[model samples]
Target: MIPIALAPASPPERSAWRRHRFLLLRRSSQLAVLALFLLGPWAGLWWVKGNLASSLSFGVLPLTDPFVLAQSLAAQHWAEATALIGAALVLAFYGLLVGRAYCGWVCPVNAVTDAAGWLRRRFKLNAGSAPPRGLRYALLAAVLLAAAITGLPVWESVNPVTLTQRALIFGGSVAWAAVVAVFLFDLAVAPRGWCGHVCPMGAAYSLIGSKPLLRVSAAHRSRCNDCGDCYAVCPEPQILVAPLKGKAGSGPLIQARECSACGRCVDVCSTEVFQFTHRFDHRRD
Candidate 1:
């Protein structure tokens, strides 16, 4: 007599778009930012100009990187009123909303590192040797110090972020090798290593958005099954520890500045435990 085989039960997704809802939105936003920059040289529709460091929108709205401004000041470099205003605008925007979300949502280099991370996980690779998170701050300090010592904004010359964006718009250059090195480092050296613990830009933005209005809260921890899926997906997994495990006194919010607000935890959880909320929402039930 042949025995009947029972199929394995597959867990169902909670939303219409399934687990990929936020991921899709994030990818589209990243690509769209790149497109706006490229549209000028590529299609002759110059909606945005000058890249993320400093950009003018339709030749009016100016956006600049506050960190770059800081480095310039450290280097004893003079800044015009427009640059000051532009940096303030960019700082205010990041402060009020996304924080280091730029690292996850807008950075052009994110595409390569993310692909490396995905491939790393697919191969079930080990964490390998990675530097401590404090290295990011060290790198940040070093960049400023280099600027001061050299009397120049040194990092801007070879920053992989700008290199990647420029390479995207223009044809590839020697910077392609740098971009490829980052991909290989993230893939083989360590997973999520670059953005999570290495990029000074991400570290600076994390500080800028240290008290951002927008945040991810483990609001419904009661529904969590201790499945560890969120931990696996989070770029800064350490941030989730306190919020998810904290009792009534610990607050339900993940307040770590390093939390990129990338929403991968929100995307991957089968139980729908995480949600975006204001910083004050401490619904620890």
Candidate 2:
């Protein structure tokens, strides 16, 4: 009879592969943030110059962002009003699907904040308690009011995206330096402090995130031993910690509007206590 040989176990090799894949997702997000900060606005400008002004003005521009292109378009095309309407729908769709995950994951400003949080941790600085959850909403209201009253995009003055673009393209300015400094300082003090407290886009997302849809939820709750590993790994730990503690009971809950849906919490959960789920699905123990 021919000798039968079993293949040696490769569990360790498979585990290493999985680890590498996870790291790649994390690192790629960081790199993408840096690229967006440097390239996003210029890309918008290019679209305008290439006769795709509608795409830039309506389809991609954030509502809080300056409508420079929109105003220019108005001057150029008096009857072409559909583009703005189309853009609004797109923005609404984004808000519905994943809330401000775009801001946390894709916005260059958030990337800067992430870097700042790293530097803060390196120095062992304390950022203190997180700001009130309602602050972003207040800021959004103020921005909209200012824009309406002044007939100009007031967000341009404070938008990190615009500031970063101008800093890079125009060889730096005091505003750019100041914003960068705050981002770095916040990083030294608080992890994701900026997104959690101050982003208007985040405020917009939070308003609609509770709608029925697929979202991150706590799974395998009985497996949890309250070790807090998930909290430590979470960018927005406060958002998930209370619920995880069983204080909020077993149900879907979002800890904050700034939750980026990055899956870091899921990755870090030692007992696999978190999973993504739709609104109608029953919570599994």
Candidate 3:
């Protein structure tokens, strides 16, 4: 269990807003993306159409979730031309720029899980033993294998991300149930379990952007005071160790694909030890 004392204490030298700037920005981004989809149904503004499985922006630009496209192909279904184009667009953007950034910035479900994590930490709740991190990769493979055998995008049936968005927009009982299950699982069964150790969608994104150029860097690792604030807040804290400690000459850049490029570490660090940077930046002070 994480102690409440590990929560970030705003250093007198840093304003509270400054300390939480990235966190605020991430929240705003997540809400803005959701608003784009909600606007069509809520207010009849069709700037973006369709769900995360496939979307059209302004009736021109197409964006498809590549993992879903892979499932279609694995099920022996020929993808539409638009789907191919959309998948390519998503792959290029995530593969070259920000790895798994979707998990941090755009995924609506992240907010739900983040809330559960906060409540767990706030109450000093003891989480059940966490499943192996590697379980996610195996689940990713299993999702694909299931798709092949079942001839369906099976994961979508119970995917909390999609269900959470649906519950907010459509208000279905099953959708709300799935969302609650994810929240309860994280709050009681595991801390940050759904995304960090079990989500195949996250696993797919990690592989898609395995070598992304954009990364978080421990540029000022020398200033870190072992305050534990960053680790307490980060969703995938394991990725921070080597870079923050300079272990085995790991350099300053956080190169782990599992890292969602979430800037919680940068936001919570009183010493300002972390920053967003390109992976090529190796400078340390």
Best by TM-score: 3
Model 2 agreement with the true structure over 50-140: per-residue lDDT tens digits: 1111234324553222133333333353323455565465456555676555554555565567567656557766656667767878987
lDDT of 1: 0.86
Q: Which stretches of candidate 2 lie over 4 Å from their true place?
A: 1-83, 127-129, 168-171, 188-191, 252-258
lDDT of each: 0.86, 0.57, 0.91
> Tens-digit lDDT track for model 3 on 1-285?
776656655546888887889878889998898899999999999999998889999999999999999989988899999999999999999999998999999888888888998998899998586789999999989999999999998998988888988998999999999999988989999888989999999999999999998999999998888989899989899999999998997898999999998898988888899999998899999
C-alpha RMSD of each candidate structure in angstroms: 4.3, 8.0, 5.6
User: Can you write out model 1's per-residue Cα lDDT over 174-243, one digit (the tens) per residue?
Assistant: 6787799889888888778889889999999999988888889999887788889888778788889888
State TM-scores per candidate: 0.93, 0.70, 0.95
The lDDT ranking, best first, is 3, 1, 2
lDDT of 3 at 241: 96
Residue 259, candidate 3: Cα error in Å is: 0.7
Order candidates by TM-score, high to low.
3, 1, 2
Candidate 3: residue 127 lDDT (0-100): 55
